[model samples]
Target: MLISDGLGESVVERQHAVGNEVDASVQGIVVQTGSITGDVHFRGGTAGEAAPRQLPSATPHFVNRLVEQDALTTLLSGPRAEGAVLMSTIDGTAGVGKSTLAVNWAHRVRERFPDGELYVNLRGFDPVAEPMTPNEALGFFLAALGVAADRIPAGDDARAAMFRTLVHDKRMLVLLDNARDAAQIRPLLPAARDALVLVASRNRLDELVVREAANRMSLDVLDDAESRELLAHYLGEDALAGDPEAVGELIRHCAGLPLALGVVAVRAVEFDCPLSELVEELSGERERLDALDSAGETGVRAVFSWSYRSLSAEAARLFRLMGLPTGADIGADALAALADRTKRDLRRPLAELLRANLVEQHERGRYRFHDLLRAYAAECAATDERESDRQDTVRRLLDFYLRTSARADYARAGGDSRGFVVDLPDSSIEGLVFGTDAEALAWWDAERHNMRAATLQARSFGLNEYVWQLPRSLMFFFHLRGYADDWIEAYTCAIESARFLGNDYATAYLLFEMSVAHYDRGDVDSSESYAAQSLPYFEAAGDTHGKTEALIGVGVMRVERGDLEDAVKPLETAVSIGQERRDLYTQGASLNGLGLLKAKLGLFGAAHAHFEQALRAYREVGENVGEGFVLHHIADTHRTSGNLEASIEAYRRAAELRLEIDHRPGAAASLRNLGNARHESGDLTGAREALQAALGLYEEIDPDTAAAVLDEIEVLPTS
Candidate 1:
């Protein structure tokens, strides 16, 4: 604006400088908010330029969000401070339709921004791809603002500066949707108060609210009425009207999530089936998410995938593993245990999941999943994580409840308790340690359902050790708390797992424990029968340790039957073994029972002790991943020593980690090595299975290397 003293007002006016200051030394030309009396008028420079209409197609069937739409209108309809950009962070859980709302509202009010609306997906949460960077977004905005690709600046700062200058005076709506964070949207801001920016993300983007004074409006899952309205939008009112009950069930299944409702609606429209049939298909939690897939990006699972994939590896793993909890929510301590990490170590990953809106922490130290999201996460666990790792996570989860139950039991009992307690894993998450009786009881009450679920889940996974041990750990706790049904139900489950194992020692031990369970419930006849059955097997297995425990049950029956002399020897033997506190049960896993299970599985002799000794050491310290490598080594050693069967078992030695390592891939080379050993040992079927599995893994992690595994599979005898 600095010029010679005689310069005309038209000179400064043509430059779009609004306001006036007459005292400047270099400028005699000043433009003011004044009425001009001359025949000439000042006008703007940007005439006949093309206004960019860069917004993507807005959702056509958008309904509901009335409150949100109204809020946006009010926030954006008014004037703003000069150079103070208007922005609102539209954030919420994934698939809550943040982008859909922002776009439709923009189109509704696009007339105000006559220069045209500018929009970019930002792809900050693309399921399979990395987020678009600020430089990329800026380049996008510049190009939309009519900047040529070749003319675009090379640096982020320069491109951003150019974008601001280009849109500075224009009234426009810039939508930065699915943004990863506030930083990604900042540089794309036009910085003109007249321009409005709507930043949509799964995160709240608090920094934008604090620093930019950005207005924030978070979307929640629709209510029952809103969900029904949304369904009508896609399926039409008659389809919903045909079956009122199914409508209710369908809405419940969708859990008020708009994406799910929309997906279900589409399927409803496409199938032309009775709404009840669709309800039947989605009845099961396991298959509900499958039914919600629209076969595109907007599918419920696909939308969740975008947010899930935005996470770091640690956060992604936490998301999947969190799916394992059977309870409605998990405490921080249990999550740490499931992850084999300390609580302090889990904060970052937990925060990461929170940022991604993958999980919600409703209360302090407690987290839960959205119902549909929990299902999706469980599906991810089943598909994305190794079965072995899943098993390990559950195992650790079960162990946390089992071990902490024992600790709580001991503390609540004033230092005297019944269940067997192991030392907390040194390097792994040490389960909660209670400082008072009330603390122990409170945790027990809160985790009661989780522990019950753990027992059933263990048996279902065929984790026989924990199947029997968990109930045993809580046996006294249940009886003391008068949970008669829990005591009976859990012991019944334990007995089945023990019998299924067919280990005489383990079977007898559980039978003996069950007798006490019956005794606690005052069922003497059932107690006596269980005792008599247990003693024979204990003696058959030469388990003097277990036999002694059974003898007490026998003596109890004999004393009840009025036969004192016959009970004398059983009493004597019980007394004799009672003196041996450090028996097989107390020392560790009874080698006899373990040996029997190993024998049944055809992994006998030479490698048994080595696998047990090494694996026991690793697992005792809570090092499952480290143990995988060690087991691989042990298999290599067995193969070198020519014990092909043991070598095969070693490659498959993921049992103790309490997970099905199917989710974790053993190195393709190692799996191929196991295949060759199985072939050498005349186990053609086993060899073929191992090679095919290895080939499958390589196809994912290293397709180039998969050829060798394919060749290995091709050479196998078909027989």
Candidate 2:
């Protein structure tokens, strides 16, 4: 080690000097003596990875919280205890500004830790989406720590272990915001003794306090002075000084809650009359200001009502109808459909709502209400809107979903020659038009929850046509996406809707659809029962197309039951109808059933001939889904005949085709079969690879099947 000659001559002065230069060159480690003046960095093996700065921007115009802020900073600002992590929870009621205070303090002290800050809104109290699960939160944290998603292990325990290892000894801050409970936080606590974890939640998280020894802080609303300061920040000191009496009344009604005060401030600015007038109107509700602020019944409602009454008729109606859908957020176009207007026409109204702050723009072209605001808006809608008018609004909303989903389904399936289209005769509002399959799928992905809510809401309103038609629109999407539970629930409601309407044809179609869903999911007995129930209704309605579908469904059931001869009549009749009507869709179905029946009867030659015919029919009609199914059957036949190489090729083709169309369940089945074929050919590496991919697709869509695939992989030969 060398010390610079420029050092001060006096030893006492040099000892306390800043920026002293030292250089050391050694093959081995160099030992340094005495304290360093500035940052000390050891340059040897590697530089540290980039730290993630994930904290949300601190709230603006944050008035004053010297006491709570001091408490949080004091509790977590110090270095962690030896061999232990520092953890604290800021617990408070909703809208009490828990997140506001936590984020503000985090930003202030972030420079204390050179390592980056990490934050996630656990969404424990989110009104729109489910609270983030422990695994989801862990996945987020690991990804932030620079772990690639594919490299992250399955199961919470594995991910937690990896998270601890990555964060070990790092000086970091982890803010788990809005956590649901202690269980959601424990696994996320870093193993690093140098790290600080600050959590904010509406929940008290009593377990973390008692069991884990986490420091707890219960936040209160702002006191009178702080509340006045907050109002001054928003309205300025001039506005507060202009009318001290009215200002006092405004602050009192707000109950010192930051959110309430913010809304009141906005209303105060927007008010045309004097602030005294606004105060006078709200002063009547002062008697209900009991303990706990009673935000639901008293103060907050007064604030929301002021905002609500201020809206123009158009924006007011939009806000009221928004309370109808259970979805977290809605697109601008969907809102237009609710009001029988175009998206363009609603732009002004949406702008008005934004100005009033009744609806916050969620993302581009989408808007959402804060949960409390949503509840109040809903109450207003119930009180103001008539019964008939409300029902009509639901009809229009459902129609919008039905038409949009149908269009998306058509785009997704490449081309559906099935002649199914939603024709809304009443309203001018239109669903979306897609330029590509990706666009349609993206819409569905974004609007899936809204669509689900629309279906159920239609049922509640007794709009039977929409109840059935809306689900039917999503049938293809539900099938391909392996959303079996959503598919079943959708059809079950549709079936009941059809029954209520006494529509035999509709009932038959629904019943057959249900049977197909059941058959695809491997419930053979239920499939047969639903198929049997549909036959009489189809016959009663004199519907040949519906009858043919029912016959094909029954034929598949009989084939699965190992009664090939009994299946022959219905399959042949279905073929006859297809030939007479030139319905390629029916031809594809009947030919596929015959192929399955022949294969089951050990007639390989006949099965191949039927399979070839089915493939051609499906291809002619642009039915990629049916084509994939026939190819899968052909692969099954080839494997049964001991043609391992041919079976592998065919299964590979089927899986590719199914996956291309987003048919995850079908793809998983084909992949599982492909793995079995590869294993039989003594290609263990290929076998395991195929099985693992299959397992991943199945886990979300079919966990039981995933477990079965896992069993197969476990028993495979390592070599």
Candidate 3:
């Protein structure tokens, strides 16, 4: 029989015959159900007898940290009394000292709970073993409460019921470490209105508050100061004081995680070596996480093993697979895709790993492995994950990104009204959804760097198709980010791949992208040569769009070289062809190029008309970045013709757009243009201000445009 009372009380009494004999034991509130030979008795201990003495382990050090003043304030003041479930959760990557803080803070506040203290290691993410069952935990708690085996309930359900009943009305401090979930922990909760329960787990256990009304505490990694203090504890004050520079490097190598820093310090102490030597070993990122650990209990791998041993097979496998992704952080949806499973199917196992503390969710809906944990996961994947499987996973992920980027780029490039689509072998992952166009753009913003790395990786893997398409999809990001080096590097690889594949169209496209990179980087001669290289291939392949883009670039290059007459024919022809093909964006770009050349040729009125037309087309298409360039060209025309006020207004508008898009280099250029306009207008104060800002930008980094800005500043008549 199973019985549960609403007010934290439950009872179960049962009897059985073993080989025609009776088996029974009773020492508490005994009732005989069947064939019993004993009565049960339970003894409760005094509160003073329950508290254990502090062991002579390493001294618990307090490293000063910027308390997330908000979380600290909320925790310290929000719900002070007991029935208030103070569900404070500290979440971070492994080695971030989540457990240490919890333990330290619990000990600091233990005086509030007068009855006694109880602790349990739930082993939520042990790598090699299953989490402790509720029965196993309940047995320990029962034993702690002075309930003997002979008198204790035989079943977990019964034990939990009695455990809660026993703790009711007693103001005890319960610290549940590495709890797997609310369910594993719910049965272990004391029902006393005044009892305090502190449950620590890596997961964002929203289920806790929903079920138990527990208040939450989220912990983050330590800052530089705290990280330093942690290292000082093991390395001693003198070593750190002798070399603050080395100390900073040491803290940085530890990645501001207390556990990692402590382990590194412990290693330093064990080896009896100079701190600078250890710094050199940790400087290499590939071996840093591994090198940070030394022998024995204090080592990071040992600390990690404790949590790893508690995981079931499924969770352990998922943990290993997670390290294979190229991304630095992962969302739930992406993680689900990576594991080839539904989020629903994976949630329980993920939660179990979180409980065991092997995996930590960085934030709500996102997760990342600890540096050391990631290293271990990488090691596991290298051995456990088959080579073919690993290759397949990488290829699928690369394809997913390539196809999605192509879709976004095609949409932005004003393709047909139909949405972009890619077929996947698995029907479950057929479509990638974006909430809005802005959301799609944000995805590019987040993934631009990773995509650049992917392009290089794809080329290294000899994926020729991906090599060509990556540059195609990455045009907007390359242009917007001003990553000239990465743009050139990606295209250089694509060029080699295209030649290898003997594909004329791919060669033309790669050459075109390479030309853009050179043009942006002020290598006008190389830009023209690359552009000329694409012309013959485009002509051979009969690709008009490629031919038009290459022609426009060549015209722009000639205009930049001061050959305005030579620029006129190609610019006009490219504009006519692009307009005839109804490629409005391309036509606008061609007209903008022609306008700049006209302005240089002293045709102000014609330049003005062309700039206005280009501006309108850019604005109509919501191409803010392109519109900014057009507005700057218009300003340049006004400045050339001495229309100072109009030039100032146009320059300001261009600067606004450039700043909006985080185009720092472009903004600097616009500021220089504004200085030129101010000098022409005879506003010396404003001119000097603008010129000084431009000079400051130039001094910080030398770019091609900076020389022109310096000439303008130098030619300004000094007061």
Instruction: Point to the candidate with the largest lDDT.
Output: 2
Assess candidate 2 and give its TM-score to the true structure: 0.73
- How much is the lDDT of residue 581 in candidate 1? 59
Residue 18 error, candidate 3, Å? 90
Which one wins by TM-score: 1 or 2?
2
lDDT of 1 at 587: 21
- lDDT per model vs. reference: 0.68, 0.79, 0.67
lDDT of 3 by residue, 306-329 (tens): 344446889888877876764545
In model 3, which regions exceed 4 Å deviation?
1-309, 343-345, 360-366, 370-372, 403-442, 579-582, 616-624, 657-664, 682-719
Give the alpha carbon lDDT tens digit for every residue of 1-719 in model 2: 32323433212234434333334433333334456568867653223467899988887868657888887778765655675778889998877788888888999999977788999877677543456667667767877876644334434565676677667888899999888899889999887888888999988988998877788999887778888998888888988899999888877777778888887777777664677987877765533223235454337767677777778898888888887776667888888888777888888988998877678885698888766677766677787898788777777777788778877776776554653344443655468898978678778766866777777777767788888888888887777665555678789999999899898877887888899788766788899889989999988988787788888889989999887889999999998999899988889999999999989989999999999998999999889988999999999999999899889999999999988877777888999999989999999999999999998776544545666899999999888
Clashes of each: 11, 0, 32
Where does candidate 2 stray beyond 4 Å? 1-56, 63-94, 99-219, 235-247, 267-278, 284-298, 308-324, 380-389, 410-425, 557-583, 682-719
TM-score of each: 0.40, 0.73, 0.53
